[model samples]
Target: MNLFNANETKAQFILSLLPITLFFPIGIGYTGIVLFFVALLAGGQYRDKWQAIKDSPMFFPVMGLLTVTCCAGLLLERPDGFWKAFMHYQIYLVLLVFISVGAGYWQQRALRVFFAGAVLASTLLYLNAFQLLPDWSLFQNYRMYAGNKSILIGILLGIAGGWMLNQICANHGHKWLRISMWLYVAVALLFLAKTRTGSLIFVFGCALVLLRYLTFSWRSVLLVIGTVIILGVAWQTATGFRERLVGTVSDIKAFVDGGKVSADGIRLEMYRITTDIIKEHPVVGSGVGTWAIKYPERAQGLMSAEMATPHNDYLLYAAEIGAIGVCALLWIWLTQLFVAIKIGGENGMRLFTIGIAIMFGGLVNAILRDALFGIAFMILLAIPLAGISRHNYKSHFGDLDR
Candidate 1:
């Protein structure tokens, strides 16, 4: 029994490291994922693990998504593309893995590890921004070192900020420290990273947390007004924030007025063309991997540049797997939100906060299509979600078996 316990402890330690690995390069993150799964296998509780997965609220919606992907792939006769897409979608299964392996106090420990990782990564980014790090070409920018886009960095920081806000709402100790951390994240995202998507997501997430925690009172109203004022002041004063906002408006205007394709304009054009494609094949889409094959043909000479994805997850999924796939995708997100609401605590708020970030991030970027962001999304989500599941299981079954 002692030997078994030691092995289990080792396995759980491996699971704990997975979230932090996401801040590193994609290869390192992938290695962590492999080690996590290996640890799960080594733990050796197949029956209980399968039961845990089945009991989770995410099971059916996730399964529906997989089924839709398969049907779309088979119907379109692109067996190769279907297989590739199927493998990509397998990342969702990590949620079930988390639900199965994470129990008792392990969930909270993993969360701390995740937050610590985010804080460390953010510090590195700041160092890179100020050129305080060792002078190396690879360390020149946060993106180069972290192997992620500026938008992704912004989203991560925004989510971290939301998590900090949740901590404050819970009335946990270290109030001032949490507030400072949240402010740090906001400054990094808005001023340093300058990601429009991140800014919007951060504001939305903070608002959601405040609304969830605050009572219906004049104080709440004043707090909301103060937030709006701060944002307004930032808009007027921050050069990066102002330029990005102005640039997006200008790009849209250029596209509408003269059909000129700039950065945002190209995405708009892609959305338009993708929508037409979806309309043509409303049932099962062009196929799982047909976007690259079909989009260029449809959009030839229509835009200045070509992209494999439409930069919108909804449109991308709709065009690839049709309306059913799109519905399944929505089901996955909506159900996750529902579960988070049902949970209703720190864990629930964490899930809700990140869920909003992912949902809003998807509007302008194919976040899940990107390797690093997709893995980060699933793992971050699974940690809190699995915590909620563990709590529910304990309440119902009275302390899960160690």
Candidate 2:
């Protein structure tokens, strides 16, 4: 059932090289395009392989989300926005299809290169943190075409954290090397970069890995709680942490007391406005690409934040496509979670870790808005899903190599 033929060799070769641009946002996008073309060229050979997707739990949910998005876009009467969403979401769906078809081969072949790329990215981010790299500042919170550095680094750190946690739980691998690497990544994230969303992901991923595999007694649980408390205390004592905490509170209070807006306050207001928009167009939302057009109408002269989408992904989608879109979106995420469950054990833990992080990121930021994070997340996610599926297939057929 080898789908890759001599005709597909060049395509696979180009696909393998896609990981080299893991750190570069634009580079990942370009590589994704190449992967898409390669996937299309080789897809005909893998008709049977592609059929395996029908057996997957995620197949329906993913397709449902895509169908809903497309329909909403078209129904909204925004052909331009519909086209834009089609291109963006269609790429993700295509990636899922490509990965599912090549599941067995990709992890073994491409994962190492991707991890190495992540390591290099980690090193570069560290250097940038220390200002060792001129003009390469590490505080990239905003979305950019190339990618958000903070978001990218945060994801890399989460992967690194998960890898290290897997090693610890398995009680194997280069223990000291991983520890050192883990510390390095943690330092870069918690102290150097100080990306709240990324740090949250790293912590969440590590916690899940440990919880999934580790045998925790009462004493161990207490120890974990103590460690978290200490970390919380330490964060409170840090100057940057204090400022962010105070700023968040001050913004909320200001908005409540005087309609004053701070950075965070603006996001709060946006959520409120977006909710109103969604309420008005609950079924078959206002339309795709009309956030900009609709947002001003809802703002009611409250603030000057000119943006198309809300800070939250769910609200953004709901506002655009209504309840159906929301259901489809949640279905997609739920399928990811269910698939991760089907892929259980250490590998499953890793995938679930990333899945939760992506979900969490969508809550606070526009997950799909950042092309780099979205593309990279899909690639990383694909490897695990493919690996798990192949492993299951082999196990089920009693064809596992002995």
lDDT agreement with native, every candidate: 0.71, 0.63
Best by TM-score: 1
Q: How many residue pairs clash in model 2?
A: 0
Evaluated at residue 131, the lDDT of candidate 1 is 73
Where does candidate 1 stray beyond 4 Å?
1-8, 136-148, 216-230, 302-305, 387-402
Error of 2 at 195 (Å): 2.3
Candidate 1 per-residue lDDT over residues 325-397, each given as its tens digit: 8788888899778878877777778888888788887888877766667877887776666634523522221
lDDT of 2 by residue, 79-185 (tens): 45566655555545755654545444445345555656656666766666566654532323322213255556666666666655564555456656755665666
- Clashing residue pairs for model 2: none
**Considering summed lDDT, which 10 consecutive residues are worst modelled in model 2?**
393-402
lDDT of 2 at 104: 44
Give each model's clash number: 0, 0
